[model samples]
Target: MKKHIILSAILLLAAALLYCSGDRQQVGQVTLEWWQFWTDPAIKPTIEKIAADYEAANPNVKINLTDLTWADGHEKIVIAFSSGTAPDIIELGSDWVAEFSSAGQLADITEDVIKDTANFLGWSAGIWKDRIYARPWILGTRILFINRDLLRKAGLGENYVPINWDQLKEVCYKIDSLGKDIYGFGSNAAEKHRLYKKFLPFFWAADGRIVSLDGKYSVFASDKAYRALKFYKELSDSCSMVDTQRRLEDAFLEGKIGVIISGDWLLKRIKNENIQLDFVTTLIPGPKYPGKSFAGGEYLAVSAGSANKTEAARFMEFITNKDNQLLFCKANYSTNPSSKAATTDTFFTSDVNLQTFVKQMNMSEMVPATPQWVYVEDIIERMLEDVLFNDAPVAESLYEANHKIKELIFKE
Candidate 1:
């Protein structure tokens, strides 16, 4: 009740401000508060330089930047919105946009974003209830990384990669036959933010979607979803579920795991480590959806509380424009540019492995855009954990999860 009251007050305040702005626009020195999550020592300086360049172009505008960490950034963002103190421009994970946008804490920038990101991928995540609330800032996709040496030692073909879920299971079991320490697959078990990411591709490839495209209802307990869960659960003997992607990547890099699905960031680490073992990248195997992968992207949104929304919108435009998008992707090699022109840059096309990531991105699916997703995902993850680790029947687990999701989306 208190939270609703606070959000109501914020919405009323935004309404009044929107009316006043229509009457008279503010004209003076403006400082746009930007909250971004690129806090790495290497990436932070690049973001700062972009801001510096934007400031130089618009002498009257100043960008006040705040650094956020992924560990607690979402919590901080929620607190900011609850307290009505959100920054003018804030960076959000592709998955986090729906919650804030649904709360009326984010400004509707649909026209502006559609104009700028016509060629952008993963726009579905930023659009909620048919309105665009955020613009795609950076995009990335995950691919299967194979340990070829491990495959050879397991007596499997060195260059062979699984093309379907059944093939993947067979390969995993083959690697398991190699030794006690060697696992066929590295999987994320019950990790909250990540488990769904690993599971969704299979769910999607099975021709099952979690919710309707319009975000109207739940559609999770389909035969395809049940089969996907059953298949994943069956691989339990040959797979180990780690709690974090870093752990999964580490196990794979140490040659303890034969097959792992990970992002392009892992590629960067592999190049840096310069390991002697030969590894290859390929699309994640799927049944009905052959090469499905998960699409992830960063988004920039303007807060409804911003007194200078026009300026904030311009700032976002400047930051996400093609030139700056290219620059950002160059500095951050793990991400692919969302723009058509930027993808053609030699930075992406010249590399055979990076090109695979691009293909995966093209074949990937964004998570559902429903506001209920935030809560529903918890239910889905718990259901997956129950099925995978607790021996819960897949059909029963998915059916119960669908019930929970329906309640979340339709409850009064």
Candidate 2:
């Protein structure tokens, strides 16, 4: 009751604030508080420049920007929304749209804006049950990074990359010169949420998805689920790779591993470290299916308690527009959700390697898009890791997971 009261007070306060802004045309003044996730230094200036441009066009409106980490942003937004002190605009993840929208803490953007304002991978990323709540920022799919230098010494070709599990296994088998100081693969498979992020593709490419479209159940206990876990085990055993996510990144960064699965974020580090590695990024592999991957991107939404909801949406629409998306992504070193931008831009289109990621995004599957997903995916990941590393029987582990998922869907 106290929480609801607080949220209500906030709503009233914001109503009054927006009311005040309405009369500001007399003085020609409006100011919006905006929040964004942390950016690469190169990208930060570009974003700030976007704000400057907007300010120039609308001299009466001022945007006050705040930077946040993903983890930090959640706590901050929750408190702000509860107290009616939330900013006018904020950045969010795709998975978060439903959670925030249902809380009555996000603006219902359906009638006011044309969602096609920006070209993105899939409009569905920010739309839930036919209502759009957020705008996408950056998008890119995961890929395999190989150290071509390591392959040659293992009697593999000077330039080699794996397209499937069998090929990856062959490379790992030949390249696991443990005593001679080499490992085949590595990943931060131990980071709880991240482990799932890294592994979702394996589950997806084998013709599996995390949740039913109705958002009611998990398929982790299904046969396809069994195959997904089984393949991870096989891949881990044969590749001589460690199960931890950072360990895998560290191994690849050190140039000790022949292959590692990573995203575009690693590009700068690979180039700067002078690792003598000719790495290529490609879709992850599968046996029963061609290797598909997961698509991850960020989105922006306005707080329901925000006083500047209308003005905030204007900024969201403007920033995500095709031309701005190009400027933002090119500076950010990541992909944007803008599908048209992605299809036509010389940056991604001209490069086969970069295009591979966009292709994988099309074939990708999303994680369960529920607040319960955090808990559900956590429970599912640990069970799969236990089976993969300890050789736990696939059927029993999957059974336990599927039953729990159903229980959770109701529980949530």
TM-score of each: 0.89, 0.86
- What TM-score quantifies how close candidate 2 is to the native fold? 0.86
Off by over 4 Å in 2: 1-28, 112-118, 154-156, 177-179, 336-339, 350-352
**Model 1, residue 142: C-alpha shift (Å):** 1.7
**CA lDDT of each prediction against the hidden true structure:** 0.83, 0.73
Q: Model 2 over residues 170-198: C-alpha lDDT tens digits?
A: 88777776445688777445566677776
What range of 10 consecutive residues in model 1 has the weakest lDDT sum? 19-28
Residue-wise lDDT of candidate 1 within 1-412, one digit each (tens)?
A: 9999999999999888876674433455688999999988767888999999989988878899999998899999999999989999999988888988999999999877666655777788898878999988788888888899988887878998888877888788888778777888888867777888888888888878888766677889999898877776667544654547889888888898888888878887877678666888888888833658788789989999999888898988888777888787777776567776677778888888888887888888888876667788799889988877788888888889998998888787
Candidate 1: residue 209 Cα off by (Å)? 1.3
Residue 125 displacement (Å), model 2:
3.4
The candidate maximizing lDDT is 1
